[model samples]
Target: MSKRTTLQIATYGIVCLAILLVPSFMDDAFILNKYARYLVLGILALALSLSWGYAGILNLGQAASFGLGSYCMAMALKLRTVPVHTGKTGLPDFMVWNNVETLPWFWEPFYSLTFAIFAGVAVPVAFAMLLGSFIFRGRVTGVYVAIITLAALVVVNLLIIDQQRYSGGFNGITDLAQLELFGLTFDAYSSSSYYLIAISLTVCLFFALAVTKSKAGLILQAIRDHEERVRYFGYDVARFKTFAFAVSAGIAGVAGMLYTIVMEFASPTFLDVQLSLSVVIWCAVGGRQSLLGAALGAIIVTGMQGALSESEIFLESWTLIMGFVFVMIVLFLPKGLAGAIESLVDRIIPEDHAVQVKSRAAASRRGVENEAGSP
Candidate 1:
């Protein structure tokens, strides 16, 4: 491998090992859980960065996909805890509280862990495909796509809140029991769970990197920069966009599944527009073009919130501070924090002496006429 590639691989290996091993050494479950949650959020942010940054598709409904996956997992766990009924059964607790007399048929499949996993991924990708087909084929662009996605979040949230019969309204599905992989029990509070999440995050990062570096990745970037040119080149732009959107939604779904497994709850608030926007902010702050940047942004933002919320002063106005910081980054460090770091590194690392000598020679030649006037 080239030196850069080898260096990158080495760096990644060291980082993964550190992330995995460090938590095992920590005695505090709370601290581990907090970081684990941050990592989960980072996974979603990384997915967003890949889809929106690399593909030039802004998905404002990412949280909807995430929420769907989470709720599916929670529902599956809830079903496993309840007794199976041959006929009609009462609704899930929140649904019963909402005055529903019967459980919805659609919810029955969730009783099986396998089926729940299927629905968790399938539902989000299906939604994304349907939504993408309509939007991309219709040639939606700029803020229109954003508006449509925001509307989707609002509509989905409202539907969940109103269904009351099927979906646990307002409250959403919660108290979701811990997951089990085959015969082994998965405890969210243990250091092992933290290791699992860390491993999962690493795997997801690899997958995203692979996808972003593949042939399809190049085509997606082309579509982003010049949709019309790609269309004229005999590619179906809409179809590609739809495919990309589906893949993005699927990744978000996985993150949501992990979120529920870790958080042990699902709520309508999880699909809020603000959550969606916050992800975009994470991408923007971390350098949208870099998946690592997106993850870093999520970690930093979550960490900042935790730190600021605990502070006595400016606790209530943390959002304002975050907003100001975002604006400054956008205006001055357009490439985000990751980009800034790269820029700084490049500046600090001096060029070869030969290159420096050539640069000075070229400069002197350009100013040759001024030499006679220098006296």
Candidate 2:
């Protein structure tokens, strides 16, 4: 095995170990749950890493996919806990308040927990596939892609808000009951929920790492460098872009579902442009090119945000502060904190393999610059 690959394996092993040990070191359930929220967001960053980092698709509507997943899970859980007469099938309270006697056809399927989980994942992937078919096949690239994604996010968010009676409107789906799987209940403030997020993050982190390290990942990177070149070589560039979009959306969908469980509610904010941009910022600050760094960026930035919010002096200005900090990171640490760590590792290791890793990374950086310059 190559030394570079070995180093990655070692790093991932350490991350897995740290995640598994979180419950042991943190006895406070509240803190654990908060960290779980950060991890859930980390998955969103990882999703962006797959599409934006590997595939060079700077999707700005990831919140739409994530919100769809959240609503799916929220709808099911909300259905179970909503007010219903003694002998009637349960329906969301808003429906009852609106004088609707029956469950909506669209929401009827979410009555089953199994279907909710399926829809939570499938809906986002399906949406991405449809959207990507149009975008990639039509040759949309770069900033146009970002604009289209942002527009889509606004559309989804407005749709959810407009149909307040059905979707809980601006308030979103709330009063969710505990998530029960295999006879075990996941309370929002409990260790079980925290572990659930941890395990999901671990599985997803490695899954993304594996994909990026595989032959498919290399080809995707090549497409990112020059889509026309790959097409000239007889490869279907659109298909691969669509696949990356679908996978990224699916992962974000899962994270959205997890967020609902951790927060015990799903709000329109999940689908907001602000959130979509925040995901991009997290990935950028962490090193969008590196999956581990992207995830770490989400966690570290979120942790600091949470900490700052608790402070009396910083509470009101945290958002502004974060925006400024993000700008600074973009200006100075354009490669992200992960890129810096990569450099540090190379220097400290004192191995010839480090030089090879740096050479390959510099080539990838050049590819990114080319993608940016592409029309």
Candidate 3:
């Protein structure tokens, strides 16, 4: 492997090791739970990086998939909550208060934990597929895509809030039971829950890394840089875009489910426009082109946000402070923190090694171009 590739692998290894070791050093359940949520947000950032960074498809409504998964898991866990929390008919308290006589037909399947878990991922993938079919196949691109996605998110958020009887309105679903699997309980405040989030984020980060290194991933990036050229090269641009979008949605869905577990509730705010925008900022701060960078960006930003919000002096100005930080980063580090670090590392590497890596990259680009130009 090249020096650059080796460095990347080492970076990933060190980061993963640090994450796995966090629980070992932190014994406070509250702190661990907070970190777990940050990790879950990291997964969401990774999802955005996969689509926006790699595929060049900026989905402003990414939280829709996340919120869907959150509600799906919340529904299952709500059913498992203590009987006292439910109505006489064993319906969610919100549904009971809204006078839901029987569980909606759509909600029946969520009673099965297995099905709920499956749906948490499946539903988002399906939604992405459906939306992508129209957005991509219709040849939507650039800011138009962003507008459509944002509009879709608003619609979904409104629907959830309007259908309070079914969706629990703006209040969302709460009184969730601890997640039970294989006879083990995952309490929100327990170490086990933190591990679950960490493990899930690790799996997602690696999975995304693998995807970006695959043949299809190369084509996706090529399309991102030159969509027309890729289409001329006989590649189905729409298919690749849709596939990336769907994969992003699936990962976001998984993050959402984990969020539900950590927070012990599902709130419409999970689908809020602000949350989706925050995700984009996380990806930008971390270096969208790098999965590990994006994930770490999310974790760091979220941790800072939590700390700032808790500080008596900064509590009221934390949002503005974060905005200023983002602007500064954009101005000074256009490629983001990851890119800046990579540049520093490149300067420290032997000149010969750097030249070799650049030559190989140029050769690879030529090879791709030559292949595309061939009959």
Candidate 4:
């Protein structure tokens, strides 16, 4: 393999290794849970990178897909804990509190764990497909796409918050039981749960890497660079955009599902506009062009936020500080932190090796002994 490809492989391998060894270095359940949360958020940022950076489709409603996934798992877990004593898996407590005498037809499907798991992923992908059909088919691009997505996110958020009986309203779906697979219950704060998240992150990152290195990824980048030219070349630009949107939504949904399990609840905050914007910022600051960069950026940014917010002095000013940081990153490091690192590494470790010698004779001898001088 080429040196560049070998270096990339090594980078990914090292990241996976770090994820695997992190729990050993820090065993506290609270801290590990926080890191798991960061990883989950990283997956969401990576999702946006696929859609925005590669396909050139900026979606601001990504949280809508995330909420859908959270609700999918939340509904199932909620059902598990409901009173079956009535000879029926009764409605969630929030519903009954709102005088919901009978379970909703849609909620019935979630009673089955298999269906819930499937829907957690498929629901968001289907949603993206439907939205992309309308948006991309109509030739929406650039900031228009972002505006439309942001509008959709608001609509969905309002819908969930207003429908108190079915959705738990502003409180969202909560008090969920643990996820059961193969008769095993996964604990939110346990090591096993952290490992599950780490494995999932690794798998998702590798999958994204594979996608970005494929022929389709190249075409997607081309479309991002020149959509009109791509369309003129007879490629179904809309189809590819829709596919990227769907994949991004699916990954974001996975992040939502993981968040619900780790946090032990799903809230309306998952679908909030602020969160969607924050995710965009994370991608921007991490170098949205690279999947690994975006994911790593998410983790680092979230970690810093947490640490900074905990400080008594910075608690009130963290948001302002964050805004300044974003501006500076945009102005100076336009490619974001990962992109900057990549450039720096490239400079420090030149693609072509450089040889230096203590003396002119030594340098001349080395040059004569080199491949170019070999006979």
Candidate 5:
């Protein structure tokens, strides 16, 4: 690997090591849990970076996929608390409140932790694939894609709210039990949960980086820059878009699952349009094109939220602050924070070798000039 690549890898390794060691350094459970939440949000930002930055797909419904995964995990935990093999006994509280005498057929498979896990990833991917096939094939692009995705998020939220029996309506799925993974109990707010989230976030980041570096990554970038040119080059642009969209949605779903573990609940708020748009803002603030930027952006936003939440007087000002941050980043720091940092470093690293280059050029010009003057 090149020196730059090696340095980057080493830096990332050090950061991961530090994060892993956080349990040893911080005894505060609340702070530890907050970091876990940060990791989950970072995963969402990473998803946005992959799709919007590299693939040029501004997905506005990522939160829907995320909510689906969260609901899957939350429901699974809820299932574990109720009686087993008793008809409708394992039904979630909201279902009982809604007079759902029988468990929904779809919720049946999610009773298994493995099934919930699969559903978390698969459902979002399948949905994205279905939508992409139609949208990309029809040559939909730009704002139209964003609008459609936004519409999807709104529709999904409405659907979930309407299905009070199964979805918990606006109250959402809550009072989740600790997760059981292969006979191991994963208690929410536990140190182990923090470690799990960190590991998952790292894995997602690595996978996203791999995807962006692969051959399909090249084609995706091409499509982003010139879809027609890619199509004319005999590439099935639609397939590529669908693939990227599916992968991104899968990543978002994973984030959603982790987030449910952090918050111990799943609600329509998870699928809110604001949630989806917040991710876009995160990606933009972090540098939409840089994975590192995306992660940083998430951390920054989450940290700010935590800070603001502590101040009752400033609670209402948080949104305004976020808006200001977004506008400032877009106007001045086009490359996002990571991009800006890189530019600054490049500027600071003076090109001493330029002296030799300039000397050679000047000598060559002087030699020619001297010869011409003598003649």
Candidate 6:
């Protein structure tokens, strides 16, 4: 491998090691739990990077899938806690208050933890496939895709808020039961929960990295750069785009479930437009072109937000300060922190070597295209 690739791998290894060592350094369960939420947000950033960075599909409503997953897990956990808090009806407190006579058929399936887990991921993937088929097959692109997604997210958010009888409504589902598996409970404030979030983030990071390095990933990038060219090359550009969209949704769904586990509840804010837009900013600030960079961007930005929000001096103006930081990054460091770091590394190392590497990669791509064009 080239020196650049080696350096990237080393950087990723260091990040993984740092994440694993966090719990060892921080003894406070509260701090660990807070950081766990940041890590879960990182996973969402990774999902956006996969779709926006690799596939060129800018989804403004990424929170829809996330909210779906959160509610699915929360439903199961809520059912687990319902009996303790409610009467013989076994309905969620909100439902009981709303005079729901019977457990909704839609919610009955979530009574099983196993089914809930499956639905948490599968529902988002299915939704993405359905949405993607329509959007991509219709040849939607650029800002139009963003608009459609943002609209969809708003619709879903409103629907959830309106269906207070079935859903938790604006209050959302609260007082969730801790996840139990293999006779061990995962408390939101416990080390086990932190480890769960950390491990899931690690697995997702590597899995996404592998996908970006695969042949399909290369084609997806090509489609992003030149959709017509890829189509002319006998590739189903829409299919590839849809597949990436579905995968992104699936990853976001996993992050949602993890979010529910760490937060101990599912809230309508999970599907908010503000949160979705913030996700896009996170990807932009982290270097969306790189999965690892995007994840780190989310974690770092979120950490800064928390620190600022908690500080008495910045408590009221943190949002303004964050907005300034984002503007500065966009004005000067358009490629983001990761891109800046890569540039600095290139300057410190040798540009000649990097140029040669890029040249060879270009030549290889040409050769592949030529082969495809031939009989």
Candidate 6's TM-score reads: 0.92
**How many clashing residue pairs, candidate 3?**
0
lDDT values, one for every candidate: 0.81, 0.90, 0.92, 0.87, 0.84, 0.91
**Where does candidate 3 clash, by residue pair?**
none
Per-residue C-alpha lDDT of model 6 across residues 198-219, encoded as one tens digit per residue = 9899889888877887889999
Candidate 1 — which residues are off by over 4 angstroms? 1-5, 82-91, 345-375
Please give the range of 10 consecutive residues that has the lowest summed lDDT in model 4: 352-361
Could you tell which candidate, 2 or 3, scores higher by TM-score? 2
Q: Which has the greatest TM-score?
A: 2
Clashing pairs in 5: none
Q: In candidate 3, what are the lDDT values of residues 17-64, reduced to their tens digit?
A: 899999888899999999999999999999999999999999999999
Q: Estimate, for each residue in 160-253, the C-alpha lDDT of model 1 and write its tens digit.
A: 8887667777777865667887776667777867877889788887787778778888898888766778888998888888888888888888
- Please give the lDDT score at residue 290 for candidate 4: 82
Decide which is better by lDDT, 1 or 5: 5
Q: Candidate 2, clashing residue pairs?
A: none
Candidate 3 TM-score versus the reference: 0.92
Q: How close is candidate 5 to the true structure, as a TM-score?
A: 0.88
Instruction: Give RMSD to native, each candidate.
Output: 7.4, 2.6, 4.4, 9.2, 8.4, 4.9
Q: Estimate each model's TM-score.
A: 0.87, 0.93, 0.92, 0.90, 0.88, 0.92
* 91: Cα error in model 3, Å: 1.4
